[model samples]
Target: MALPSADQTGNMAEMEMQWAVKAMHHAETYMQLLKAVGGKNFKLTPIDDELYSDFKRNFPDLNIAVLNDDDFKTDMAKAKWREFINKYENRVTDFNFGSLLRIDCTGDYSEDNTMFVMRTQFYCIEIARNKEGLNDSHHS
Candidate 1:
């Protein structure tokens, strides 16, 4: 398939890349917080326990320390994630928005390891990472 040119894809300013830069910063900030407070003490919210519980309940196969980009991208995974995220849709702000997530909790985001995911899905995985101290390394 031919790649779409900027013209064919419409104004670049109106593209996801524009907002993606901002989203990257947000993700980085969250990572910084994890480094600062130590992942074990970093909470995504007051109900961190419930969020972590639901995450494990729904995704027993997923590895929170090293995420697979396909986990949420594959059709089968999407359905399960959607159902799990729906439980927090009303409470979590912008829970369904696209956000960048790092594949590994022990490293910084990079071109090869970052993937787009729903904000709440990010929350689920990240909450688990923090709880497990997976991203608590000084360099993370």
Candidate 2:
């Protein structure tokens, strides 16, 4: 096997960086859509409602209604999340692949309130978070 030339390696790194930027842009766009629709008060489209139901069914033990739920920190949650990610691996667009997901919609869009999560997982949580009562604390 031959080693990649320095220029080739540099190009690969640059391409990866561009992809990261694009992903961040997409995330920002998603946030904008959420805000435009009224953030936590936004009514989820039917597709999002179905996804939310699936999330509830799959992770029944967790309080999905809680803002920035701490259940994700548990070992069981991690295992279930891995399974959840795998289940939707081929279905979700941009499928996470170690992408940062913003947890708190009202907070600054930074690493502090975000964590690496699968794309579907992001939708599930955000939809749940945007529910009327669940996210009122943040807005209030």
Candidate 3:
């Protein structure tokens, strides 16, 4: 996407780009964590391996095709890009923190084809840094 104009005050466009980058980075980290945990048990079909290899081989081309498109300057294009990025962020956050589950039923019934299931639980902690300056600047 085109970068936000230098003088724009409410820079939601740039913010969306920043958020997308952060979300993608978070996804990569999560994938790395999954790989580290699954190690030997991690199963990759030949098709999956080939697809991933191709993605790696042409990542720059794919990224340029997606992100450097000429229509990004238009308001409709920006809005669409924003919507896509928001959806992506919501999906990632759901996978990480939301109560969503998926079951894989890939094989024959006789073979007991319930292959995979996953549950994710996430927690957050916040600490107050200082209340000393709270509301004082407003009064002044």
Q: Please identify which of the two predictions, 2 or 3, would achieve the higher TM-score against the true structure.
A: 2
* Candidate 1 residue pairs in clash (backbone atoms < 3 Å): none
Candidates in order, TM-scores: namely 0.82, 0.64, 0.24
Q: Please provide the root mean square deviation of candidate 3 (C-alpha atoms, Å).
A: 22.4
The lDDT, on a scale of 0 to 1, for candidate 3 is 0.30
Error of 2 at 73 (Å): 6.4
lDDT of 3 by residue, 13-95 (tens): 88767765664454445335333543223322223343334334533232221123333335775564345334334333343
Model 2: per-residue Cα lDDT over 43-80, one tens digit each: 43446677777888987665444335456657887787
Candidate order, TM-score descending: 1, 2, 3
User: What is the lDDT of every predicted structure here?
Assistant: 0.79, 0.64, 0.30
| Winning model by lDDT | 1
The best-first sequence of candidates by lDDT reads: 1, 2, 3
- Residues 1-140, model 1: lDDT tens digits: 99988778786765667688779888889867766777676577767898888888878878787887678778998888888888887888888888888887777778888888888888888888777767768533
Clashes of each: 0, 0, 0
